[model samples]
Target: MKTLTIRRPDDWHLHLRDGAVLEGVIADTSRHFARAIIMPNLVPPVVTAQDAVAYRDRILTALPQGDRFQPLMTLYLTEGTDPDDVAAAKESGLITAVKLYPAGATTNSHGGVRDIDKAMPVLERMAEIGLPLCVHGEVTTPEVDIFDREAVFIETVLDPLRNRLPELKVTMEHVTTKDGVDYIMGSSGNLAGTITTHHLIINRNAILVGGIRPHYYCLPVAKRENHRLALRAAAASGDKRFFLGTDSAPHVDPLKECGCGCAGIYTSPNTMSCLAHVFEEENALDKLEAFTSLNGPAWYGMAPNEETMTLVRQEQPVSYPSKRDTGAGAITVFDPMFPLHWQVVE
Candidate 1:
């Protein structure tokens, strides 16, 4: 078996829903990642420091026994989010970042900010306090084509915002288009992007080629092949500006399989294996540590994990459960559409 060892990685962006779903899914992440920036888009949304603390408590309580995982809490950015409360949460070391979800952009995001002007106070506070703002990075205007939203967001939203507040550190979460990649690369270091495992592996074609593949559908939905290639290059390029964020948003099987299904790809269970395969295929396995472990912490202004994990690539393909059982319902696992040979030998 071929083996690779590196500092244990942390998912820069993740979503573990509340209650039974959170309990059922937290282990998949805690098993492999040392820490994760938990998404805050819930039913009512985590809008305050108090809400963040409570959510963090639930996440910690739900973690499997003996697991050494940490959940870096985030407050969902809404028009009414309090600036002083956000600064306090960051100062307390409980809130790692604040997430910006454009209103009605994705699942459970109705409470997201509809006007940047209304959110300026909170954004200014975060920038002054050196807290990062993690953005969902898509516009919700009905006229903008879904596939073109990311690029349009750069022109009409992200660029203007950055110009207004260059000191603010921003993470463009789960970027899917080359336009997004190029924009991040050309921008100042204060701006960085997270490339999800699914975005790097599948293109829009995966969702439409052989009938409608709901499991492959995700928000900022997968782009064209060229965009996928761009994402892979960015991930493997050893650029500190880019890192791993699975955006492993999970939905119950029923919710994902019906008419007008939810948008997300559940990838926590086998993200490392899939990532290993991608890096190896790109001949950049040597740089995988930077993409998976080092860069994220560097961008977030934290140290990399002291812990280490080893991955073994055996001749036999790795096997993963087709679906994960949750009290809410059965949730599907991401299938990379190719055999994975690397398994975390924890």
Candidate 2:
């Protein structure tokens, strides 16, 4: 068995939902990551600098004792968002970026920007202050098929946005298609993207392979095997433009298993282990550290974490925890299908 050690990794994107669910899930993230860009799409949404501060405090309060995990916050971009508020949040150092979710694109994104045109002033303000705009890149037209949303969004939305605001830094969050991979690659140094664990490990077939595996279902849903191959190549390419972000969103079991299932995968507890499996299988284990630790901070203009962690290539069966206990109740956990073989050494 081989042993590898590298700088402590940060999850550039994650969802640590509020209160009980947060309490139950924070430890899983803290155990594996030193910091995470916390999504602000709560029930009411964190739209202002003040809201972001309060939300950050709630995330801190929810973490287990002695955990040094830092929750990097983001402001939810809405049609009526004030430019001054965006600047104020960035100046306060509480927010690292602004999240743009096309209205109706994903979970709790109904408050997201309905028309990107309406938010030009906000995006401009962010560009001025060096705040990157993290986008949930998917078109929500009723006529567009689910799997085609990402590619369509790039052509119809992102490309136009880039042409319009050439100075603005954009991160195409959880990119799932070959077109997405090409867009980021074609953009070179300016625009970047975050790849998720589930997207790298599973394809759309995982959803129906064994009779509708609800846990494998996620928004910006997984695509065909060829797309998965493209993602694998990009992540393993050691390209600084690509980096790690678990998008470890947790939903209650009942909500996920219901008729209209929720969209997210809860992999915070096992993200690193899973990535190690994928990278190792690709024979790119040597480049894992750059993708998992270095690329993200470089893209964000922050330094890599000073601390280090180790993982050993040992075969081990990891049980899937169906639910994480919190003050309220157990919040359901997503199943990553197979047992993980790598173990992180603290």
Model 1 lDDT, residue 131, Cα: 93
Candidate that scores best on TM-score: 1
lDDT of 2 at 259: 93
Off by over 4 Å in 2: 318-322
Global Cα lDDT for candidate 1: 0.94
State TM-scores per candidate.
Answer: 0.99, 0.97
Steric clash count of candidate 1: 0
Which residue pairs clash within candidate 2?
none
lDDT of 2 by residue, 1-346 (tens): 4798989999999998888888878899988788899999999999999999999888888788898898999999999999998898788788999999999999999999877889999988887888999999999999999999999999999999999888899998999999999999988456999999999999988999869988888999999999999999999999999999889998877778889998998888778888988898899988899999999999888899999989987756655566787775656665666777778877
Model 1 quality (TM-score)? 0.99
List ranges where model 1 is wrong by over 4 Å.
none
User: Candidate 2: minimum summed lDDT over ten consecutive residues — where?
Assistant: 328-337
**Pairs clashing within candidate 1:** none
